[model samples]
Target: DPAEAVPAIAPTTVEEVNTRFVVLAELYEHDIQDFHALLEGHEAGDERYAERVDISARAVKERETA
Candidate 1:
């Protein structure tokens, strides 16, 4: 799953900023788990699935640091 959270603008208000963070946090949490499950289900012969799992894992890592 692709996860993205975009506010109407650059989160100027306190509430909008907080909401954006909340949305991002939720997305990060869910995507990490979803990608892990996808990795677990990938078959040995499925090179494309393996590649995606690898890419997704890296994306999760990047999001974690961001």
Candidate 2:
């Protein structure tokens, strides 16, 4: 059943879990912003980097949606 599909939580402190979550969130935001800047740079005629930036932006969007 559906209930059995869920995984059990470990016996960790709430503070520890929150701290780790914040760190990961900050990293994600930083990467998204960096990609935005790269996209802007590419739009200004940086053909060599445009594709990579575009891909990165798409990836970020997908993750956000998920």
Candidate 3:
């Protein structure tokens, strides 16, 4: 699943900044899990490495947008 959308405006207030931080934290947490899964799949010599890599790439793109 994709992370929640962040405020489009620059975070000018403390609350806005905090909200952004929370959103980013959640995004990174999921990113870490995706990477872990990719690594495990690589180590096991899984036939689906390419698919896992695509997943990881998409997750990275999601992070970039956030």
Candidate 4:
């Protein structure tokens, strides 16, 4: 059943699960901001589309490592 899909292992407590999500949210927070910055005044079909994508990817990596 769908209810049995979740693995029954460690981190079984609600607090533990919430802490994991909080850490992930903090890690990706800056990446999301950098992505939104790229959306301003940019279009998917533009000549610089690939370049913009590359730049955003690098920004996300940098933020994650910082």
Candidate 5:
């Protein structure tokens, strides 16, 4: 089920968002980098992993822009 798991950006109000994102980072830390970059621009419906990348990227962008 590891492959089925994907990182996501939780709502700002959700505490678990940080925890879950950390878990995802630990899990996928060595899995992919090029893949993540390639998928960052993808529409969520393109794939689950793609959605995860989008979510993660948006989270970073949101913070950076803030």
Candidate 6:
């Protein structure tokens, strides 16, 4: 009876894992673009960057929920 275990095919190919990685990489690019845009029109050392940082932080938090 111990010899009747079902067999499963795990992702043993590089293509499969690479496809998943590509999708994640795309999401990361989009997030970074959004972050950069948030900081646009603001100068360095400006307090306005705090608002942008808060927005980016909230976005990251929301992404964690997803």
Which structure among the candidates has the greatest TM-score? Answer: 3
Q: Which residue ranges in model 5 land beyond 4 Å of their true spot?
A: 1-46
Select the stronger candidate by TM-score from 1 and 2. 2
Off by over 4 Å in 6: 1-9, 41-66
lDDT per residue as tens, model 1, 8-41: 4443888888998999999999999999888866
TM-score of 1: 0.44
Question: How close is each model in CA RMSD to the real structure?
Answer: 21.0, 17.6, 21.0, 17.6, 24.0, 16.3
lDDT of 3 by residue, 1-66 (tens): 244565466539988889989999999999999999999878787657767999999999999999
List residue ranges in candidate 2 displaced over 4 A.
1-10, 46-66
TM-score versus the correct structure, for each prediction: 0.44, 0.50, 0.52, 0.37, 0.30, 0.45
Tens digits of per-residue lDDT, candidate 5, 1-66, equal 885697775557456778889889977875687568667757455787877899999999999999
For candidate 6, write residues 1-66 as lDDT tens digits: 665786666756888889989999999999999888777645454667788999999999999999
Worst 10 contiguous positions by lDDT, candidate 2: 42-51
Error of 2 at 11 (Å): 3.7
Clashes of 4: 0
Candidate 2 local accuracy as lDDT? 0.92
* Alpha-carbon local distance difference test for all models: 0.84, 0.92, 0.87, 0.83, 0.78, 0.84
- Indicate which candidate wins on lDDT: 2
| Candidate 3 Cα outliers beyond 4 Å, as residue runs | 1-11, 46-66
Candidate 6 residue 23 C-alpha distance from true site, Å: 0.4
Per-residue lDDT tens digits for candidate 2, residues 4-59, read 99999888898999999999999999999999999898777776578789999999
Residue 17 C-alpha lDDT in model 5: 76
